[model samples]
Target chain A: MPENSVICLKNIHKSFGDLKVLKGIDLQAHEHDVISIIGSSGSGKSTFLRCINLLETPTEGEIWITGEKLKLARNKKGDLDASDPRQLAAMRARVGFVFQNFNLWPHKTLLENIIEGPTQVLGKSKDEAIAYAEQLLRRVGLEERKDFYPSQISGGQQQRVAITRTLAMDPQLILFDEPTSALDPELVGEVLGVMRDLAGEGRTMLIVTHEMQFAREVSNKVMFLHQGQVEEFGHPDQVFGNPTSERCREFISSVY
Target chain B: MFDLKGFGDQLLAGTMVTIELALASLVVGLCLAILAATARLSDNWFARNIALAYTSVIRGIPELLTVLIIYFGSATAIMAVARLFGYDEYIEISPFVAGVIALGLTFGAYASEVFRGAIIAIPKGQREAGLTIGMSPLKIFWRITLPQVWRLALPGLGNLFLVLLKDTALISVVGLHDLMRKTTEAVSYSKEPFLFYSAAAFIYLALTILTMVFIHFMEKRNSRWGDK
Candidate 1:
């Protein structure tokens, strides 16, 4: 692992019964590197991203973030032990994830949704949380719609708010799981634009996306996963401009 | 010929008791429903099984039968225990208390399902998002889960409450002077069954209409954010 690497996944393996979704995958993400994982649907790109945050625990392997190996173990009686709830919670706090569905809390106003994490999770004062929420809303260009509910906003606007909600957590790493897959084609550009802005601002991001243009343009590194393994992993230009793997070449051609 | 004025007072008194019993039961039922729904979703097998059994047993039995069991059977058991302890010769369970317990238990059984559905309707990602932010489970329930559950469960819960309000009449058999019981008493005394019964039916209709208006206001207030 590189000295500057913020996230390291070593020999990571995950399976759902007999179906091996992620097989012995190793990945290292350095600070401020926007690593985009691109592949066809069911390539385990999303599963791999979810495993990084322990949303879905790996069946076998080690995940290290900021030099600490996250404690993922079962008890003698074969149950998840409750002793490390704090550690698990702390690990989750450092990694924020955005879902494809823009899963904003429907009961809360846009502003409340944005502030909820800061107030409830971080124990920030209500006024401070609100102020930070407003800043994030403005940063994402949704300040005018801060009072609107998720159901009231357009897909593009809702995605932007989802991004702002993630930013409010002040995570060291942000994971995007097909962030634009649920948006309309016309609305896709707006969400991608926000992501592009985040990339420009040097935010460390691991994005799972189908948008070839985004993978090519915004990512510092691109990894192509086919059949539960990283087939090609390198700079965007090296992989996209001149691919070594026949599968990578075929995938790039099919999409482009 | 019936004396209409005297019959009206007795009916009014009965109507008040019925309303009180229904409101009390509804409040208690909603509280229990939330707890049971939470337990039903818990990972612990004991908690989940207990919640399931409570809902199943209450739902399977007829409401009138439940009332009879609690009012008669439980009262006897309680009096026996009291006698053993030498606290009193006979420990009487009031019909009003029995009615509340029976109705509330039944309401809770139905309301648990409604609450569970609403909780499940919320996207799993929202709770994940809450956890990432570091909110304790209790705070998450209040801020993230509760508001959404209330919104989703409103229609189902409102319908249940209406049914509960009508079911208050069943307590009349246990000798609690509810509206239905009052109507019966008034009819027997005045020898005018049709006139008093019609009055009682109208009262129920008026209460139902009033409940609808209140529920409409609540739904509108709660959904105001969605319209923005």
Candidate 2:
């Protein structure tokens, strides 16, 4: 792994009993790098993104964030360490994750949803959290919709709010699990636009997306995942323009 | 052989008692229900097991048996405690208190399931969002979980309340002057069982209708927040 890498996953393996999902995967993301992961459905792309945030615990291997090793402490028997509640909580706080379904609290307004993390996790005062919430909502072009519930907003708007909710934590890294896949075709552009803007501001992002055009336009590097392994990874042009691996060429052609 | 004046007084008094019993028990039952549901979902095995035991025992027996047991059993227990505390003389447990305890216990058992379902129905992500926002578990339960639970559990709670209202008649067996007891008393004096019983039935029907209207209003108000 590079010394300045923001995230590093080495020899990571995950499985669901009889079915293995991620097999000996090694990947690294540098600071402010927009890395898009593209793969066919059931290709373990979502699982990979989830593993980065520890939403799904990997069966084996290690994840390092900003140079800090995320290791499961084992007993004398060398069994996998089952994380205690406190450790799991601390790990979750550093990585902000946006779900594909825009899992906004249905009971809270957009403004409340954005303010929740800062007040709850960071223990910010209510007044300060509200002030920050307003600023973030405005940045997402959701100032007018602050009082609206999640059900009242469009999918694009909800996704933006979800992003702002994560940003409230001021996390060092952000993970997007098929962020725009659940959106309507027309709404997809608005969410992708917001993501592109975030990329422009040099935010470190790992996005799982099937949108080839989006991958080409926003990502500094694009990784094509095939059957739980990285088949090809490089600058968007190198990977998208002239494919080296047969698998990569076949995958890109199929999508096109 | 109808004693109109006596019937009027008894029926009015009974109606008042019925309302009081239902309202008091409803408040107490709901409070206990929330506690019981929280305990059922608690991390500690002792608390969860205790809550489970309470629900199971109460649900297993018939309502009449429960009412009788609480009425007599609590009176004995209270007197025993009083005796231990040096009040050796008779400590009468009032019929009103016994009725409240019995009905409240019954309502609480059903309400526990209602509360549990509501709490479980909420998406886990909502709680995660609550934690991420810096709300302590207590604040999260009150602000995020409880409000949504109330909305989701309203219909079930309404039904429970209606059942509880009807169950107030059970208190008549304990010498409480609720609708059923008063009706029986009026019927005996007036020698007109049909008329007084029919009147009591009408009153129950009216109360049920009023309660349904209130429930409808609540559902509408709560749903408005999420509606576009």
Candidate 1: clashing pairs of residues: A121-B133, A121-B134, A121-B135
For all candidates in order, the CA lDDT equals: 0.87, 0.84
Cα RMSD of all models vs. native, in order, equals 2.8, 4.0
RMSD of 2: 4.0
Chain A accuracy of model 1 expressed as TM-score:
0.95
Local accuracy of candidate 2 as per-residue lDDT tens digits, B1-228: 334555877788788899999999999899989999999998889999999998899889988888888888887888899988888776667778888888898889899999999999998867765554334568778878999999999999999999999999998998898989999998888888888889899889989999999999999988866556
After superposition, candidate 2 runs with Cα above 4 Å error: A1-5, A66-84, B1-16, B31-57, B76-92, B124-142, B182-196
TM-score of model 1 (CA atoms):
0.92
lDDT of 1 by residue, A22-67 (tens): 8889999988999999988888999889888777767777778877
Q: Under CAPRI classification, how is model 1 graded?
A: medium
Best by DockQ: 1
- Model 1 ranges with Cα > 4 A deviation: A1-4, A75-83, B1-4, B7-10, B83-88, B136-138, B225-228
